[model samples]
Every structure is written in structure tokens, then in C-alpha cells.
Target: MIHANRWYAAATAAEISTQPTEHVICGRPLVLYRAASSGKLVALENRCPHRQAPLSMGTVVGDDIMCIYHGWVMNGAGQCVHVPHQDSVAPSVRVDAYPAVQKWGLVWLWIGDADKVDETLIPDMPWTEDANQSSVFIRFHVGANYQLMADNLLDVSHSDFLHASTFGSHAGRKAETEHVKAELDAWSEDGAVYGLRTLRDVVLSPMAAAWAGTDKPVTRTHKTCWTPPNNINIELIMENDENKVTIHHDHLMTPENETSCHYFLIWTRDFSVHSGYPTDEDVRREQSTVIGTEDISMVEAQQRNKIQFGDPADIPGAADKIVVAVHKRIAELQNEDQGLSAT
Candidate 1:
């Protein structure tokens, strides 16, 4: 289920311009644009009240959007400002407006109660603003429940099998795949859930070794933290006798519906800012390939199976501890929203 009180990423800041962009979050169609006058970001219901045509198809005029279908103009506040061949527009004629803001290079919106709009709820990705680091932002549309995608990120054990050819190549050297699953730690605190894994003296995948500028075995520490409403940040630290490197992966998921979601990912690294083996484009391409092809492909199939079987009573493995905790945390949040005790 979708939580109303949390902020969800609607689009990247670069995606919103004078030209309207459309996105669906929490099953609500929204049109996002920047005002020509004040350059402020605005989010409105995609549908126009006059003809039910998509407002995103219209043009931005000053701090307002004019519906192209019938020349109905709506102010940034969603109030009807003007109408063709009419002196004044009806006060009751208006569309829904959602609070939108740009934070950490993303356009975030609040689709719930006006009184509950909280900017502080937006998580911080300080690496995005750091000048010394290299950061790449990528997004995709996943054909699965947002929870399924969350499950994928919370449980990294699948990396050995699903991403063997790419990021998990070195981790899958053994047949049983028990080495990578060792030292798993899961916990919940302060409205968030977390998972940590530490691998010592392990061979890095080709891509990761190239990033580290070394192919030698290294101690790798991986941690995943999940905030409410499907925001995850993964911090990876790799160290050896020569050098140490750190990378931060920030992932945000917003529900388009029960069966689909929009995934936003930002990959930031403290190393490789200047001359490096993996250029920014290289990092982007590799990350896009692993996530778009490997992770998303698996989740979509999982969604299809879930639809066919309704719900399966499969046995849970040891690596599923974090995934289970995250599921329970989400249920608790939903219960709190509904004024019911968590079961």
C-alpha cells in the first residue's frame, strides 16, 4: 500500500522545465513544470477540469498553465485564472495542486494532507552536493510492486546469482554462495530499518576492482538503510593495503500503482573524480546495465509470479532476515497511518 504522509520523488530537477512533464505517483497522475515568472516548481493534477484533457499537453504562461484543449488557464495554486471569450472565470473551477520542491537534484512532492506536508522528511544525500565527488543519477520504470523492489535492495544475497556476470562475479566464485551471506546484521531504529554485511579479503568484481584501481583482494563493507515509504541508501567501503574507497547508492521508489513503480537511483563515489579507469559515463553505463537488466528483470518476473499464485508460502532463507524486517517495518508504518496497532 502507498503511504500518503511521506515525500516521494516525482522527477529529476532537470526533467522539470517550462515544458510540462508528466509522472504517476501513488496512482495519481501529476503534471510538473517550472513557472516562467518566478521559476518556482509546480505540481498539478494532470487532468484539466474543463475537458479532462491532460494538462501536461498545455503550455506554461507566466506562473500558470493554460489548458490547450479549451484555453482554460490555471494558476500555480490551481485556481482558474482566465478563460477564452469570458471576462472572469468561476471561483469554483480549479484543479488539484500538490506541494512540490527540488531537493538533492530531485523534484519531490507531497500527495497527502496539506497540514501534514513536511520538508524535513526528505532524506539527505550530501554526496550529491559535494564538488569533489563524482555522482551519476539514473532512473527506471519497474513493472512490479514497490515492495518487491525494496525487497531486492534489502536482500543483497541475490547478487551472487542474479548479478553474477557483472557486480557479483567475484562473489559467486563458490558454488554454495554461503561466503557472501556471512556476517549479516539487521535492525530497526528511529523509523528506519538497516542491514549490514562485511566481507574480508574477498576478490572484487572486475568493475569494482577497476574502480578501486586495484585487482587485489580487499575488505568490503556494505550497508543498506531503508527509511519509511521506500527510500534506501547503500554505503560501500572497500579498503586494502594500498588505498580505500567509498561509494554511496541512493535509491528511491514511488508507487505508480499496486503492480508498478518508478525507481530513482543516484550513484556517488569519493574516488575517481579526475583521471580514472571508469569515467562518469562508464560508471553510468555499468550501473544502468546491472540495475536495469539484472535487478529489474528479476523483480518484474517475481511480480508476474505473485499475480498468478496470489501469495506463495515459500520457506524463508537465512539471507531473508533483512527483507523480513523491512516488510514488518512497512506494515507498522501503514498501521500507524491508519490509527491501528501494528500486528
Candidate 2:
């Protein structure tokens, strides 16, 4: 749903430790740095119009970000207030300043029409503040439609067959998907499409039972949800008789181009220190390497087919309900956007 705002993930908390870092998201250049004295954060255009030298090339002053070329310094507002080579009284030269909000340990940038972005509409994610739960992030670039990646992330049933040995259920129980609900945001940007798809299934695994110290064919029901413009959550209940849920998240496509998508995803699992995995990062890497490869294959194949087959213009089947919903939402949002653009 970020399509509606100027919203872009500028940088991570770790990357901005003290020095300024240049980041590019959705093709928009950004510079992020923390204030030396007060630890305040700032995000602005990476390019300094004066010489087009990247502001990120500059180091952080007390609270200002100073350019390395000729020592032109700008404050949090991105206004050039001091030119070391020039008189200290030089008139302020302001660069394009992006409205940045620091939340969820990531700096969010508003890159669209500055006057229209509404920060209030930012999506709410509950896990963003779950400090007790540690996490690891895995990022990737997909050579397909952003929507295609979102659709794949939202589909969990494919795991059974596609990821037979890699973090997927081999039990092959009598599983089924039931549509829970779908929603579209009314207040996001021009052509922002947002929705959710839920698939419910029961896990009946003999292997899991043996590993979990439980009876054979231990069965448990779980809920999986797919939310877009950018989110997919799969909640799996392990045999804790305790409904242990692991959430896998997806950030919908930030289009790298007309035909490619730059995507980010992370799967969250309760840290199991004694599961033979010393750190959550290892578990994350294992899962991502396996399942992520599987998805990349399918997504890339789909793209290839489209190029050779010429869109086919029609897809038929029940396996495509979520895809249908995605297309519908995209059309709706696009139509609304066209009108706004004309106005």
C-alpha cells in the first residue's frame, strides 16, 4: 500500500550508526545520518544540487550533514546554512528535503509530491515493536512483476509440492484454503492497491511428531494471510500444544523497472536457542536459501512465459483467486489514479 505515499524505506538502524549513508529505494536517492550530539535522524536527497556531489559523501557535523566537496553544510532541514569556503553569512541554499519519519527501526521517506503525502496513513504493523522477539531480514531482487512476487509470497499451499524438503509440510494432510476476507485502503496514494488473502490449513505430520516428542500424525490448524500493497504473513502453529506462531512477511514490489521488481522479505520465527541453531540469523538464512530459491524459479519462469506466450490474456482456475483479487485491486486503484492525475 506504500504506492500511495511518498513512502520509501530509506535505511536501516544499523547502517546509519554515525556516518551518513546513501540509499536508493524505488529509484529515488536518499541520504540518512544520525546527529552526533543529540542522535537525531535525518533523511534527504542524496544529491547536492550545488555540485550534484552526493550529500552522503559528506560527514556528519554536530547536527548537520556536511558535503565533502568544498564543505557545504546543511542542517536537518536540508538547507545550506554554511559554506566554509564562502562568507559565514552566505544566504541559505535549500535542497529538496524529504519528510522522514523514523519508526520500526527503519527510516521511511516520502518521495512523491511532498505537499500530498499524509504520514497518518502509514501502515500499522504490530510486530514492528515486538522487542522480545528477535528477527533476521533477507532481501532480494525479483525479475518479474512486483504483484507476481506478492502473489507468490501470499500463497502457502505451493510450499507442499515446491518445497518438499525445505521448510514445507511433507505430511500431505487433508489441507484446504478458505478465503477469510479482503480489504482495500481508501486513503492511500493515487493508485495504491492494498488487500489480504487468508488460507487456513491443518498440519498432520508424523515427522513433526517425532521431532516434537509427540504422538504420530500430530495435527494442528494454522492461519496464513497475504496483505498488499506490501505484506504477507504466514502464521504456523508448531506442536507446543501452545500455538507457537511464526510470521513470514513480504514487502511488495518496489519496481526496479517496467519489468523487474526489487523485493524485500523476512520470515520471523520464535528464537529457539537449543534447536541446534545458535542464532535466528542462521535459521533465517536456511529458510530463505531454500524457499526463496524455489520462489525465484517460479516467478522468473512466469515472466519468461509471458514474454514468449504474449500474456495469454486469460488465466483459468481456482488457484488464481488471490491473483484475480490482486488484478482487480490494481485496476481499481489505477483507474482512480488516472482521474486524479487528470485533475
Candidate 3:
């Protein structure tokens, strides 16, 4: 229910350090650093109140950030600790602070109204709850609304076209989606918080069965959910006639602006191509046109139309059933924002 209470990715695991790092979240200029004494990462608004200088430009000396402008010092909580050229303690001036936690190999911060930041909304991954998964990490950035990119991912149909040159399987596409099963999943509020693994089935159309020569369906079962304005988590198993199972996940994180997103992922058991991890780089290397031109062309076009036009086709259809369900949930969350008066 908070405006910006959700946690977001601050930096890659390799970049976080005792040295203070400045970043903007939800459009709030913030700085992150490790405590000198405890080595715990902390987040604070980066601007100095006196002259509006960035405190992150200062030094991280002994558990405090010393502003380079005037040697004004602040502690981990953004509480002012010292003001040079004066003996009297400054009347407890402090910069805004955000709750920060480094988990899953990324620094997470809560940036909405702090009072409304529910820890539960911070996001929990039970599968990543294990330590070994720590070794797996993947990162990528796409220029698009975190939501649009997520919707594109929620449906695998794109793989047949967007990825056709590399991942195309005419047998797979012509394969009867109807034979696979049509599942209409939705939340009256939001959409795609999958509970029953909707996209996990192995039924091939007669074409695929004939091509792959499998009498039965070759199903890869999956469960996934998207957290807007930018984030996604998916877990799935890939299966062939051999009946062996491999597990994988796609993890996404969004910055405050919703213009671009970061992806952190793991391929514990699944191959990179199937996971969309390597294909991302492959498309970049082999077909720079698709990743660079096509993706940008589409997102920019979509943004233009989105600005000029109203919501496109609010109703739900076969391909858009998932999108409609998701729009519903987002509408629920933004409902309060809708009712507020300009006054």
C-alpha cells in the first residue's frame, strides 16, 4: 500500500563495499556504504542539506561519511555527528534514511514512505533460501517499462518469433497450444502470482509429436510472478522424453524510474540458451539488430503510443488473458492513487 516502499536493486554484489556508493531509487538520490565498525551496508539520502552537495562525494572514515564540502560528518543512520569549525554539537541534523538489506547477492532498499514499508513486501524467495544458489548470478538491462518487458517474458510465445532465428521451432509454435491446455489465471486485484504452475505442460501438437516423434507431450513446467513497477521471479523444470528434470530461475529488479531494469538470474540445472540468459548475449553478439534495434524500436514505439493513446484494448483475449489479470492487480494497488484529488 506504500507509494515506494518496495525494495529495489542498488548494485551488483561485486560493487557493494565499505566505500559509500551513491544511487537514485524511486527518484530519490541515495547513498549506500558499509559500517566501518560492523561492516553492515547502510543507505542514506545523498544530498547535504546545507548546500545540497552530495554526501556520497565524502569519505567513509570510521563508520561515518565526512562531507567533502565542509567536513560535516554523518553516521550510518544519516545522523549528523560532527561539524568542523564548531565545538557545539549541531542540533541533531540528519539526512533522510532508507532501510537497506543486502540479500541474494544484491543490496535492497525500501524507498517509499518508510512508515508503510512492510517487510513482507520486501519480497521473499524460498527456493533461493539455500546457500548454494549464492554462486549463481546473471545480470542484464533492457530499455523498456519494467512492466512491458515483464509481460513479454510472462508469455513464452515471443520465443517463437522474437527469438526465431536462434530458438525457432516451427514444430513448437505450430504445436497446438490448445492441446497443451488453456489456463486462465488471474487475481481480481493484480495478475500472475502463479500458485499452480499454469505454464507447465508437455503436450505437443500433432506436428511436434510427429517431428519430435514423441507419442506424448514434451512438457516444461514453470511457475512465475511479476512485481511491478519492475521485477519478476520464475522457476521451472525442463523435461524431455528422457524424463530428467532441470531447474532454473529468472530474477529481475527495477530502479525507481521504471525506464530500465536489471536482471539477476541463476541456471542451476537448466542450460543458458533455454533460460534466456545466454540468448540475451548471443542476440547481442550475433544479431545486434534484434537486441539493439528491435527491442529499442518496440519499446520506444510502445512508449509513444502509450502516451498518445489510452490503454490499448483493456479487454482480455487468449494471449492477453495474463496481461488483463495483471492489469487488474495493478489497478487495485493504484486505486488509492486514482481517488486522490489535485487539491
Full-model lDDT for every candidate: 0.85, 0.58, 0.57
Query: Where does model 3 exceed 4 Å of error?
Result: 115-117, 129-135, 167-192, 195-217, 227-230, 261-301, 304-316, 336-343
Count of clashing residue pairs in every prediction: 0, 3, 7
Q: Residue by residue across 1-343, what tens digits does model 2's lDDT show?
A: 2355435554545657568887655555678888899887787779875788999888898998888988888888888888776776445576767777766555666656767877665455556467655556556667876666777765555655676555445433344442222221212233343333332233433333332344432233334344334444444545445434444353535554445666655445454533634367665666567646788879889888988999787653554555555566666755554412201
Over the stretch 207-260, how does candidate 3's per-residue lDDT look in tens digits? Answer: 223323345546544555666544565555445655544444545545434565
RMSD of each: 2.7, 5.9, 5.9
Per-residue lDDT of 1-343 in model 1, one digit per residue for the tens? 8776778898888889999988888888888999999999999999898989999999999999999999899999899899999998888999999999999999998867889999999998989999988889898899998888988888877765676556753553466543543578889999888899877777777777777767788877879898978899999888899889999999999888888999999999999788765778988899888898889999999999988998696577887888888888877877787622111
Q: Which runs in model 2 stand beyond 4 Å of their true positions?
A: 88-92, 115-117, 143-145, 170-228, 238-245, 248-253, 259-262, 270-279, 300-316, 337-343
Candidate with top TM-score is 1
Q: Show the colliding residue pairs in model 1.
A: none
Q: Itemize residue pairs with steric clashes in candidate 3.
A: 4-112, 26-256, 189-328, 189-329, 190-329, 200-221, 202-219
Better of 1 and 2 by TM-score: 1
TM-score of candidate 2 on Cα atoms, chains taken together: 0.73
From the highest lDDT down, the ranking of the candidates is 1, 2, 3
Pairs of colliding residues, candidate 2: 1-229, 4-189, 6-111
